[model samples]
Each structure stands twice: as C-alpha cells, then as structure tokens.
Target: MPIQTSANSRLRQSVGSPFLASLVSFLVGVSTLLVATLLIDAHLPDLSLASGQPGWLLTGGFLGVVVLTGNIFLFPRLGSVQTVVLPITGQVLMGLLIDNFGWFDSPESPLSVARIFGALLLILGVLGVIGFLDALVRRTPVVGNSSDAGPQLWLWRIAGIIFGMCSASQTAINGRLGVVLDSAVAAALISFAVGVATLLLIILATRTPWQLKRIDDGPNPWWMWVGGFLGAAFVFGTAFLAPIIGTGLTVMVILLGMMAGSLAIDQFGLLGAYKKRATPIQLLGLALMVAGVAAIRLF
Candidate 1:
C-alpha cells in the first residue's frame, strides 16, 4: 500500500472507517491534554487530594469519553446542530431531574414551575433545532433506506442522548469531587487522568494498535488536537460552577453556550464539519433555548 501522508489519508486507509478516524483523533487530543495538564500541575505548590472522598467520583473522565466519542460518531450523520441539540435535550431534562432530587450528591435545588416550563421549552427547542417540525411539514423522509437508515439513525441519536445524560451526571460527579478535593484543578486533573486511563484500558481490551507516532506524520488542522484541552476546560468549569449554581443551572448555561457554538460551527463549516445555514426556524429554536435557559436561571 502507498504510504499515507495525512491524517485523513490514514483514517481512510483504516478499512475506510470514519469511526476509526475519529477515535484516533480523539485519543491524540485527550492524550495531548493529559500531558499538558500534568506539566501545568507540576508547578502548583499543593497538588494533593484534600478530601478523603470515595474514589468513584473520579469517573468523570470516562464520562468525557462518552461525550466526545459520541460527538465523533454523530458528526457525520447529525451534522453539528442535531449532534449538539439532541444530547442537550437529554442533558437539560436530566439536569432538571438532578436538581429536583439532588442526584449524584449535588445540592437540592428542586425544579420549580418555571423550570418545568423551561424543560418543555428545551424539548421543543431541540426538535425545532433539528428541524423535526419542518421535516414533518414537508413530509420529507427524516432518514434513508427505511429498513436500515431509519433504525440506524435512531440508534445513533438515542446513543447520543444517553451519552448526553452521562455527561451531565459526570459534571455533577466531578463537582462533588471538587468539593472533596477542594480544588477545581485537582478535580479536572483527576478526571483527565482517569479518562486517559480508561481509554488505555479500552485500547488494550480491544487489542487496538497504539498510534501515537502518527500525529507527527504530516500537517493537519490545529483544532483536531485540542480535544483534551476542551475536555479539561469543561470538567474544570463544571467542577468550579456546579456547587455555586447547582448542576441543573450550570448545565443549562453550558447548553446555551453549546447551542451558540454548534450553530456557528455548522454555519461556517468550522472544524471540517459540513456547512449548513441556520434557517429561520432554527433561529427560533435557538431563541426558545435561550428563553428556556433564562427561565431556568432567572425564575
């Protein structure tokens, strides 16, 4: 076989699998992030875990894998908007439930009537964002090949939603860990390290080859390597803010930002995702989400 010179080329060479491409990309990004986090932590004066909390709280790293890997899988089929929206639908709903009952050791911030309405709005907003309404109006087939495409697409979407819920739970878990550890940085570091460890276990269990050297093969988009950093930012942000605002509100705020970022990424075709414009309906969906977020926060 001819030598593969680029990242995409290598991915294509791997049995022509996009999943493998995404997997490799994610692994590279996360590994890069773990190393960077360690280097930065080395300079901090106190790096010990302060709280003698249960170790299971560190599972935030595994949850990061679910969210990031799910994104890579959905990016091709759902594009950017649906990829972000559907999961966020699950996120907001779970968040509401979490706050209502104080799940995962988060503080009890019961869902009020405003929050219930906000949850409904968030659901409708997701459907609108993904154009389910328009697709229904036009009677356009939502997916393809009826037999295979429809089922497969639904499966992926469901998986994405489940991943979204796991991510929400992970944020709450990490936040609690932060309470125990007394440092957001420590919480984030633990999550990233755990995530790296989990990925390594997965690779070993599946007997996949370690492709560390491939990152140096040639030029690629700089953003492809920022997965770990993005993950760290999220874990740290959630850890730092979850206690102050409660997991539900924190997730809503994050969801708002996610919506804005997803819209921009799709609109501009950023990061190699397909370019798709935000239609008037989708814009309405975005407005609804903003309103819902506001309702959840202000009321």
Candidate 2:
C-alpha cells in the first residue's frame, strides 16, 4: 500500500507538475522501450521494416504522448476506477467509428446491433465498478480521490474524457502505421522513439527538471522500474494486433484482458490501490463486460 500511496503523491510532488510527470514518464517509458526494441531486433529475425516507410505513418507516436499526459492528468482528478473506465469507454467508441468508416486506411468492419448492446453493457459494468449504484443508494455524489474539490474538477473530468478519445484515436492510427511499416515491431520502435524525442524537447523547452529517475528511488512498486517494459509490450502489441484484427475488436479483446488485470489488482489491493472487495455488483458488471465483448467481437 505504501507503494501505491507513495506513487501518486510522489508523482504529483517530485515531478513538479502533472505536465512534467506525463512527459517525464513518457520519456522514461519510451527510453526503456527503445532499448527493448533494439534488443528484440537483434535477437529476432525480420523485426525491422523491409522497405521504405511513409513519413506520415510516424504520427502515431505523438498521439501516444497525448495519451500518457491525459492519463497523468486524469488519475489525480478521477481516481483509479474512472481513470481506467472512462477512457476505455471513449476508446472503444472511437475504435468502432474508425473501423466502421475505414478511416486511416483500415479495412471496413461495419457496426452492428450486438456491438452496440455490448457497449451499453460495458458502460453498465463501469457504473458498477465506480459504485454508481452505491452512491445512489447512499444519496451522495461519487467523490473522486482528489483531496481538494473545486471549479476545475469538472474541467479536469472533461479533459480526461477527451484524452480517452485521443487514446482510442491513437490506437487506430498506430494500427494503420503498423500496416504501413509491414511489421508491427518496426512501428512500435518508431512510435516509442518518436515519443521519447518529443518528451525530451518538452522537458528542455519548459525547463522541467529531469525527474525521470525519481520514480525508481521512492516507495514505488518494483513494477515502476518495469513500467517501460510493460508499456513497450502494450504499444508493440497494439501495433501487432490493430491492423490484423481491426482496432475495435483488438480493443475489445484488450478490454477483457484489462478488466481481468484491473480486477486482480483491485481485489488484492495491488500496488497499494484502494482495497475494494469484489461484490455481486462488481461481478455482475464484469460479467456484463465480458458478455458485451463477446457480443461485439463474436456475435
């Protein structure tokens, strides 16, 4: 629990600002990823792009910067539950739109009623996770984790929601980039490297102190050291799957995995996360989420 509690407080304080935290973390994450990418390329055959790749395809990395910063801003304002769920909902919706329209040179995957119903169920699950029903019963507002509440609360929430949409957009865009590069690993490498450069520029231009190593020294989880590896796996996996499965389906599958992971963390109070026992309401919500995923992808 110290790791979890310390992680949040340290991030806000040590990095000086949410903007710095986001950029610095992204810088660290991408730096870690760049090393991984190089190692993987050396170890594995055919990891690199075979031919010349387009210039525009590289924009996916910048979008990732946005995603990281948005999450950084949202966590303090929205708490863990909403931080994860709201973005997920927005991302799923964006993925659907991208697939249905064939945007970003993606293949068409038309929308259907089952997918819509599934999305609704997923939303229902989100409400349960946040204890929306519990709040209603208690006749109280759902308070976020923030110690301070004021006018900017709504602004942060709105910004958080917008960031969620950006994240979903990035997924789709990166998937297309993967297609262009002809190899997912190549796209992942480019994305991470680009993100690292962008963060580096921001740090210098804004005069943010180099706090990239700060996360490693505190009461942070050992996982914090491996955040880069975790992040690398995700970005690489997104590029790997997005084009092949389409972003909507890819995100649906990813959502299921995330739900399971989130449940485990919350159940065990992993990383010092707030301890919330899995009640029937939460279970039903999870079941609905799974069912919704099935409806969208399988039905």
Please give the CA lDDT of all the candidate structures.
Answer: 0.68, 0.69
Off by over 4 Å in 1: 1-52, 68-86, 143-161, 212-218
**Total residue pair clashes for candidate 2:** 0
Best by TM-score: 2
Residue 98 C-alpha lDDT in model 1 = 81
What's the alpha carbon RMSD for model 1? 6.0
Q: For residues 87-140, could you state the per-residue lDDT of candidate 1 as single tens digits? A: 877787778778889887889888699998887786677666667666776897
**CA lDDT, candidate 2, residue 202:** 69
How does candidate 2 score on lDDT?
A: 0.69
Candidate 1, lDDT over the whole model? 0.68
TM-score per candidate, chains pooled: 0.76, 0.78
Off by more than 4 A, model 2:
1-32, 35-56, 74-85, 143-158, 211-221
